[model samples]
Target: MLQNTLEVSVVKNLDFIESGVHICVVANQVVPNLAPILDRNLKAKRVVLVHTADFLQKAKDLASAYSNYQVKTEFFKIQSAFDIVSLRKDMQRLFNFYAEQKPLINITGGTKIISLTMFEKAKEYELPVYYVNTDDSLSWLVPDVESVYHLEDRVKIKPFLTANGFEVVVNELPSSNKLLRQVLDDLIANIDGYKEAISQLNYYAYTASSSLKSVSLSENVEGLRKLVGLFAETGLMKIENNKLIFKDEDARFFANGGWLEEYLFHQIKQLGSKIPKIQDNLCAVEVCKKTNSVKNEIDNMLLCNNNLYLIECKTKRFSKDQSPEGGVSSAIYKLDTLMRELGGTFARGMIVSIFELSKADYARAKQYNIKIVSLSELKDIKRHLTSWLS
Candidate 1:
């Protein structure tokens, strides 16, 4: 209960100013450095990012985020990440320039040597020092202040991504249609009943999208009629004269395994309501990294407890027997890379599949530290999500 459950209030006696605060942050992970600026009560005027050469572009991206938040940013580059003597010289110069400004230092980021150098220099100069923890607490460690304050959840999806050197070029928010939600609930409740039918529907949907806007099923497949009727009730599809007619490409996409994406996005929103720390969520987001032109489309992304959760909803069927180029393994690899690239160490990646995978694929997901929630888990999704958030 140190800080995670301490989203209570600000410190009472030790009052902080609302302006003229200059914080020099050890820039490695970006969010910790941006915390103080996001707190309106602190009202940071400028932020001096102290980063190594490797993190130069990330630091610049963080500067852009500061500019977006109306806080100016400066840079202090270190020549070496681990060389203590070189880092001390650089820290000395940074401290000399920032001394007159009475700037503070945050040791929440950077390598251990860098943080140690910055901390020792701040103590020598008798300047204030701070550190941010994952639990959303700002600790004032200088002069044995022993004070910690809970940070407000003021971060948005766009700025958070921007600070991490990624840009949200295109985003589409989820629509909470009652009928669509009902269809999802029905599918989950009757998961076993619709498994085979949904698989056939996926095939037909994919074939239709590849060829025509519709498909004529000559044979009345078992349970397909009922499943199509559920989708038709949600206005997602219709059966006309032994044919499954999709409204458009979007409708076809939904029919062809896109429903799981829609389902998971809404499920996260529902989880957000019960979990107060859940902040922002977006589905169908296309983000690109600024340093390199690498692009990735996120099926669903949620901000909870100051951490981004990247979720990939897959309705693609997985085989019981293993193959070298299998669906689940590929999904695991993609989720692992995207999570590390976009969210760094502060993010969690999850793959929610409508079908379970083989033991080898499950082990592969575990190796990559990706969470897998499949059909059985989806039955008690809220409970599973609660455990996940915990």
Candidate 2:
């Protein structure tokens, strides 16, 4: 049986003589038992085993066991096996020799190198290759390729064929063929079902930070920071003294000058347009920086006719569990005082926390009719703002 396999391998290589093929027989140290399979079926005049230093002892043991085999099997140490440089050099040498001698079987050990270099060289030389895996669990060979067969289940044929562009088929193979497939499938299915039933089921949803890291902040804060960074990346803002400042890059800022006021009013306008217009023509004012006023530096202020809006912009960093209750309360007090000074001009107040907001803070803002806009939500706001302005 071994002789017949060897004859077939040799015949296949000869058929592609113009390609000057090199047969790669790959095995792992854990599966030293696969050595004989390569010895029996590969009828090449010369065979080479690409073994890593980690598997040298196992290769020697296998070599000693098969000392009586008629085929000459030589071992080549794969220096820095994982390194691309070493693997490429080894593959070049192997392919160059195969071009000259047309070796029947060039067995490579381990999947790491086999999947990378050896397989690459086989494709380059159009060589007939076979993988000898020690693990009897699942087939790693390319699916549907008759030339590639697993030693454990030779009868179970792959659904795909062996070709240069065969990765598409192999990638599509059912993950059930993997050992952990069942566990993963069950977990995902349960999660999906739970998510689907969540809306219908009256369940109390609470937000908590993962214990994996300290200084846990809400996803909102993290997302806003990322957006700020993206704006900086696009040269819209510059970081100075750990604060984001609008860059004087374009004259568009002259029309929408104050960053915070412009950003908030734009969002309110966008949201109001989507919802029913409870108010008329939008008006915005910057009151925090008013001279002689004891109010905290207000980011932006908006007034839609008689409906006045006060906005407090904060780029402060806070974790998921941390609430900006104190900061927000201070802003509300300042805005109230400012509104009183302006003869009750402002009707609505808004706290634009560019960072994550704790569940408590979010609920608190909702109670006061103050909208809480997260950084991720701001992206959608900006997209609409562009369309509205355009």
Candidate 3:
């Protein structure tokens, strides 16, 4: 019989006791079923078995089995519904019992509610909760536990004394790595299409601008409207208050400085002889100050040739740091006003940006026939001009 499998040895130890000796027994049995011992330990006290909604029937079955073992077990039903009221009520009842008897074995394996409720109640009563699972294929218990045993078909055990806050080690858990990789690969593949679309749109905008001999501000605005419309149709950009607002996800590539400058230069050079060329050292002056108050410190101005091409470059960065937008905008406004005051002697008006232009800005620039280039396409303009000069 199972009882004979154990060898029990009793020893009497007499320390400094006056007239009594304590007897201690060491038993080597088929992993001495602690269920019976634990039940006896809670003899006259309240022993509540907190169960989740999903495993309520299973817990009841386990309690019935324990009855045969002559252990007194009381079933405490805990609901695991998404409803907040029911969950709160269940927590209240569990906390009340925890304050009274302070259970030894708190099982939480079936549902999230069990873990959530037990986690709160365990802190109040300082109770030791054990996760009992029917699945033996994997060990659900956390490490640091003293010992574990298999009871019939169910996995049972008492964990080591854990602190109030314990974090689960998810790295060791089994997961679908292959599926995750496949999903990531598919996402990257789809993003390539957006990149290509933006490239085509940039090319079209640049080519259209370079083909113009000398455009007025009104004509420039019209051109921008056409470009913005194209972007909206192709879903690369959206129109908001005459401005091209990039969808958040696609904003990064559209704001690429290198690409914008290259496209701008390419289109400008394509203009050929339509744009007049003043002498190389003709003093190309850039007025970078705002229009309202003229900072007549002419020495601070960046000098170019008499064929001065004033460009206002705009862009937005993720940081709060000062971007080129404010400086560039202020510079353009002041220069334009200054040139107008000087009887339109300036060669040309231009606006360059690392960002897509808004409908209003685009229209404003077009109305002045201001040439625009993206930051990325800037290098291409110089290269195109070099070829023209060659």
The residue-level lDDT of candidate 3 at 187 comes to: 24
Number of the predicted model whose lDDT against the real structure is largest: 1
Whole-model lDDT for model 2 versus the true structure? Answer: 0.40
TM-score, per-candidate, Cα-based: 0.88, 0.29, 0.24
- Sorted on TM-score, best first, the list reads 1, 2, 3
State how far residue 227 of model 3 sits from its true place (Å). Answer: 97
Query: Which candidate do you rate higher for TM-score, 1 or 3?
Result: 1
Between candidates 2 and 3, which one is better according to lDDT?
2
Best by TM-score: 1
- The collision pairs in model 1 are none
Off by over 4 Å in 1: 1-13, 16-19, 25-27, 210-212, 218-220, 319-324, 358-363
Residue runs of model 2 more than 4 Å from their true location after superposition: 1-41, 104-108, 111-114, 133-144, 147-390
Candidate 3, which ten residues in sequence have the lowest lDDT sum?
157-166
